[model samples]
Target chain A: MSSTPVFITGLGAVSAAGTGCAATLESFRNGNGNPCTAAREETPIAKPVFTVGDPAAIANAEEMRTLRLATLAVDEALSDARFRKRPSDIRVGVCLGTTVACQLNDIDFYRELRASGQASAVVFDRYLRGNLSAAVAERYGFCGPTLTITNACSSGTDAIGMALAWLRAGLCEAAIAGGADELSRIPMAGFNALGIMSATACAPFDRDRQGLNLGEGAGILLLETDAGVARRDAPAVLTCEGYGTFGDAHHLTAPREDGSGLEAAIRGALTTAGCAPDDIGFINAHGTATATNDAIEGTVLARVFGTDCVLSATKGYTGHTLGAAGGLEAVFTALGLREGWIPASAGYKNRDTSIPVAPVTRMTNVTGRYALSTSLAFGGNNSALVLGRQP
Target chain B: MKTVLGVHGIGMISVCGRGIESHADAYNHTQSADSSSPIRVCRVADEILKDRVTLKKMRRADRFSKMSALAARDAIDLAGLRVSDGGIRLGIVVATAFGPHRATFEFLDEILDFGDAGVSPTLFSHSVHNAAAAYIAIMLGSRGPACTVTDFQYPFHAGLMTAAVWLHEQRCSHVLVGYTEESSTPMDRILAQRHRGQPSHEPVLFNFSPYASKMFSEGSVFLVVTRPDQGGVALDLDRFKTGNDRISGLGSLWAAFKDGGLHLPQH
Candidate 1:
């Protein structure tokens, strides 16, 4: 067989639980609430915001605004995988996904430049477009491939898939793959304009689910080829078996009601993994609290995994991290495999009568070999990734 | 060892000249134009562009997608593949550091100022990061797997790798790979604000081929790849492999392409 098995050696997350990966994982295990009430908003916000602590505390270093979340995730992942010395000998690559690329910074600088026509070198420095990925590569001194995948919500997932392909193809010895999107007014206003923002706490797979609370965070996984792993001391956390991607092509902002595209993506991923429907032990669904996405995802899951498979949508806790959703969710699935415990859906309450699928309502002691992580984007693109447990 | 996948046709548009001949000539006579400072020359002149109809409708279409479509069309023509008559099973893969940046900034400005008010649906629709690939698919009527990859470094190589994998899997007979970047007003304004000393320059395109002589410029480039038995476009593509002698596999790619073509200059 020409297939090469790739392993996930490192894991990191910079989410509501602060910066470190272990802290975030511990917080999740303890079922701690990361959501906090916003002080600026006039109205009493129903849904809590998971801002990465005070922006001012970390905002002094403008570069931190561009890469703080990424730095946290990458650091934690590198530590978790126990790859001590930075491996520059082999081609080390990075793939990040995000829609909010320092747009806030650009907006702040543009206001000055547009009005005065006098440009501040500091103003436009962070928005240099390639600065984020280049910064990561530069900081870690990994001289290989570096890319940013920005397909809205699927950006992180697609970046991971791309990294997986690169590793299998022997293009790079290892890759740091994930996505980061700090909360910005641009996305906040865009979602609000679309009328998808829920004034109350967002609930996934719930009958009364209104919408999603826009959250900001980052997650990264360190993947390596077989040759690179020979030098590693720590065992692999999980193996990325297969990935499948397909566009909606039906609509620009909405998913197909028939769930054709999502079904195709799910089936394609399963086929690539050489797995049957029953082989999927856990499903990290793209259960954005949006009505259409949850309903469509429910229908697709019923068709693919049936009603019996254990499932939970993590957005209720993480909020919709936009581009980082896939990466963060993938870490959750991988961690689930390592810990032998399935995390609950966090906020799912009443089941939607219209959909046949049921999300696992509480934490369960489930030991399974394979987990499927999925994501759906604004452009009707659907991506499914199958992560196989370490052998 | 994997079989060598030869390249038959390639096209690109950037700050560089367009067409295989112009690209070859521009690079054959290598003289750096002093554009006011240490700034590099990058852009495709308007005079050399063919198939103007394809770009007429996309008003807000950034230079990135326009360059990609134009170069891809050129490659398709160079390969003698006519979609008007009967198009083959074609796939397109494009790589970029960013996508439709001009449109994205415009949308941001409008939405921010307008305060979630009624915005241009057209602008909002085309502002997607994948608009470049989607537009190419629509233009070519290619229903195959069309993907746009965005990564800051080696995007072109990444795009080609994707195309190669698709071809290796026999998913499609031929795949067209493109790389595009456009100078945006936001970028310019920001650059000027950040660096008062630097001068801004226009962007251009440059095409590559297994047959074309070397010249260095970045814009858009498309390669039409075919399986060995097809005996299609008579160009060599095996020379572009980045593998070393240590690997026993892919020997054909190494032998057939051993220094037969001009290598792409590092960015």
Candidate 2:
């Protein structure tokens, strides 16, 4: 990997907090989050979810909700980076992290197959293009290497990490890295069966927290190389310092009781970024509010950052967006660094005594150049990204 | 910071049979095309692993996890690296388009058969997309970084690039990067519907899969990658990126998208 810094020049976000980066920032600042009151169409469970706003007028539904959400996010990021007017060839790369959209579990089609063992190709084709990195790349006319990572919830963070590797490896001049997933019945059913979906809006890090509320959205960042930025005259927002990931290899759905994988991943990120634990201004934790996840992550955070560490868990604001969680949190972390305020951990009133970790209940100002974001996912995949303020 | 990795070992599994020989033979067939069936990747039957001693722990494991572990063992043996030593740093990266769908579907069945409250946790445990990658690391006793990527568009390329980055960053001295796909009834049915109303042609691997005949086969290809100075055929990702690339494991992936059929890059 090149020692040269990788810059996050532009960013876009669309989540339950609302569209655009400013909306989420304002919601975080005001503690106003909207979790859907009713279940989605044909959903198997009654659990609430956080869904993104309507599509931009220009983005048609034919593009699919999942793909359109991504396009909308990317467009905002590009415009934020001031690349809309200046159109120069800068070899772009697209790496998206997703779950339902990328997989083949169309319930209606599967229901028909289960009934009569038959279905139509049209539905399959639609499902095929619904969630893919190539589709997003093709949509934007990008020819750089495209990859879709499905490491479950940790995917978005890994995508950002992978995009940084691509930049350091000189794979492309600029890259689009983030994650997206639409709310679907299949996952809702799966999580319900597993007994993790909260019936109401989730209260992350709360002592009496029930479980995670499912949500849908997309978070994107436009990364540019020095040469690309110089050519396009784009402003660098923040530096993508380092990314580190490791798997527990201990269980499939459950994280290790010790959280050794996440600890190692954090250490790896710190080592890669050459930043000390004290240097991280605040942490954007993957506090899903599930019993095991919260305990494992909270324990790890307490041990690493000590009791004084200011932590934030945004799941309360936007629910657990699964694959998109990492990207959204990373964008929030970037916005926090740029604006000099860390969003409070939404829905958190009291901390769990057993886990022994607290979160920022109000948007708090901090003074530091580096921030850490962590994702503990289903595959026992633990990924951490170190985002640093640009000098 | 660019480093070369020697392709110390290679392991493959498909429906044709086990070992590299079976996979190689399956693709080299010169017979004519006249079949009315969707191409399925070769699967590992119980009889195949009945004799293998390394898979004793896989008795209760899902086939997806088993395939990745079995293929990785073969590659480790071929690479001449003793994983039991635990001294060699290893990173594992596995990529698949349809991840552990057999188990995922089974979990779905459990949910329907037994209501949400009565579902089995074990079933859901094996159904996650990263299960196989986790199993691979555990089976190898590799304490290094491990990751799983799912993307139908060139998973091997993504996996390879990841492996290369791990090598360059010195995160892991050796990376076990591979691809694993399992054939499932629902997926097969979906593919069948996608290609329905037309006669199925003979199976062709690495050939042009023009929307109509895209080869969605199952199987795994694992390579033990190390520094070039260690010897054997060197794997250079940048070389493949620029041109004149003959990357092992990632056969003509370019053919799938290009209307102009894929031509093997010059050696």
Best by DockQ: 2
lDDT of 2 at B40: 44
Cand. 2 TM to true fold: 0.89
DockQ of 2: 0.43
What is the CAPRI rating of model 2's predicted complex? acceptable
lDDT of 1 by residue, B2-90 (tens): 33555656665644366554544443454453343223433355454445686664444556567777888878877777644553656
The per-candidate count of clashes, in order, stands at: 23, 3
On residues A1-391, what C-alpha lDDT tens digit does candidate 1 reach at each position?
A: 2368788888888776556656665666665445666522232223465677645534644664537777778888888877754674778888777767723335555566556755566544455533456678888888866667667788788788878877776668888988887766555555766777777767888899888887888889899887788876556768887777765655556777888778877887787778888888888898988999999999999998887778868777777888888888888878777777766676678989998887777777766678899998865678888888875
* Candidate 1: segments with Cα more than 4 A from true spot: A26-48, A54-60, A64-66, A88-90, A102-105, B1-5, B8-91, B116-125, B138-146, B151-154, B165-173, B190-221, B226-267
Q: What local lDDT score does residue A32 receive in model 2, on the 0 to 100 scale?
A: 59
Error of 2 at B151 (Å): 3.4
Model 1's DockQ score: 0.21
Q: Candidate 2 at A255: error in angstroms?
A: 1.1
**Chain B TM-score (each prediction, in order):** 0.69, 0.79
Worst 10 residues of 2 chain A by lDDT: A55-64
